[model samples]
Target: MRQPSSSAPPPAESLDAVQAALGAEHAAIWVYGLVSAFLPEQFEAPVGEGTTAHRARRDTTERLLADAGQTPRPPEPAYVAPQPVTDQASALAVLVVAESDTAVAWRAVLERTDDKALRTSALEALTGAAVRATRWRRAAGETPAARAFPGQPA
Candidate 1:
């Protein structure tokens, strides 16, 4: 990738962190599309919401990278789920994992950046991921619907 203009001062570590989060968002959008097929009609609303949210975040993160003169990473053509999502149980399980991955990625951004605005945005994304994961867990009747410290490794 071409180096961003020196005047732009895009810190390599921070740019790398946001790029990782952007990739997670892309993967999330794709995962939601795939898992939606296995969800019930009642899940249509949340699924739609999740897809929309991820798209918005992805776009915003891309803009942030571009503003810093850094090239954003593109989405992959395909992603293999950690496991087969053939049923509602499996679908929810995969969704939870995807959302958790996003949370972790955003948290990495938070850790790498000193910019107040970027920190705020990363926190919002992280919180959103945590909430979405909790919702899926709730639907699956998993215990502890929310994590105490989301993005922290168990």
Candidate 2:
């Protein structure tokens, strides 16, 4: 009976979690691109920025997988968006939800890992998500929401 090796399972990323989170990140990257279709002309810059940020995180996640000697799973063909983003209003709503979900996913990673760098990255992602959510809410003609914020606390 052979025993399992003690390689520390790479450094961070609960593969189970990474599978789900990676899917989320991938979806977010895709959603950000589509969201622009529904955004107002005034929102192009901000939404573009958010899209770029998501793209950066997507790239970083890929690097994490490579460093761990694991190939990240491909994202599902599609994800169930919260609702149809047919206009600026719905686009903002979708953006908020996307950021919030991303934050939640990163928080789960934080719980599943002890790597300081990963922890820091998770915090960064979470904080960015919270900020984006607030911005999205404001963009959608709403007031700033509560302070609970999404994802793990700093």
Give the candidate number with the greatest lDDT: 1
Once fitted onto the true fold, the runs of candidate 2 whose alpha carbons sit more than 4 angstroms away are: 1-13, 152-154
Put down candidate 1 lDDT per residue, 1-154, tens digits, no spaces.
7555544454889999999999999999999999988999999999999999999999999999988877889999879999999999999999999999999999999999887888999999999999999999999999988999999866
State candidate 1's TM-score: 0.93
Off by over 4 Å in 1: 1-10
- TM agreement with the true structure for every prediction: 0.93, 0.84
Task: Give candidate 1's error at residue 9 in angstroms.
Answer: 4.6
Give Cα distance to truth, residue 133, candidate 1, Å.
Answer: 0.3
Give me the overall lDDT of model 1: 0.93
Candidate 2 residue lDDT tens string, 4-64? 3534454444655655567678888878887888766888898888888887888888777
Q: Lowest-lDDT window of 10 residues in candidate 1?
A: 1-10
